[model samples]
Target: MNLDQYLPVLLFIIVGMAVGIGPLVLGYVLGPNRPDDAKNSPYECGFEAFDDARGKFDVRYYLVAILFILFDLEIAFLLPWAVALQDVGLAGFIAVLIFLAVLVVGFVYEWKKGALDWE
Candidate 1:
């Protein structure tokens, strides 16, 4: 097996590691060591932490976050499909319609369940 083909992969790994760790290394070496009460304190939403670190959070918080990611990714998929509309033709169009139908059904289900309600 020719080892030359692996040279680029090795270099890529080295560069990737350097890029990932370089900032931390430089910051630790060059940055000042400073810690104060305000800087080290737990902060939340422009205020100090009011609850315990492991306090229970409302289930709706997680539900909303998951729904946001679900809808966000589904929307992101539309960009590629739109770009390839000419190549995919009618079949792709119908597939996307079905996908959209499913998405709408899920949204409606969540809405009916009051998952979207903040209060």
Candidate 2:
């Protein structure tokens, strides 16, 4: 094979690498060199770190996070389904209905179990 055919590919690879690394190299060369206690200290949520870094968090925190992710993913699926509604026909509509019903049931179960309670 002629290597000339690969010239564009090689140029693309080199340019991609330069675009990715150029800013980093320039920052390191031109950025500030000062470090202070406040700048170097570990900061979190507007407060100083008071607990162990590996401390166990409350299960409610995880529960809420999981619920958020579940609904977020449901929205992701919904956007695509809506965009393709004309192409999916009745069968796809029914399938999404069932999916939504199941999600509603789970939501109700979680509500009754007080999993959504903050206190």
Model 1 over residues 35-115: C-alpha lDDT tens digits? 778776756433355547786677877898899999999979999999999999999999999999999999999999999
Stretch of 10 with least lDDT, candidate 2: 42-51
> Model 2 — TM-score against the truth?
0.63
lDDT of candidate 1 at residue 33, scale 0 to 100: 88
Residue 17 lDDT in model 1? 100
Candidate 2 residue-wise lDDT, 1-119, digit = tens: 89999999999999999999999999999999897777756664434544467866678768988999999999999999999999999999999999999999999999999999876
Model 1: which ten-residue window has the lowest total lDDT? 42-51
TM-score of 1: 0.66
Clashing pairs in 2: none
Model 2 bad stretches (over 4 Å): 1-48
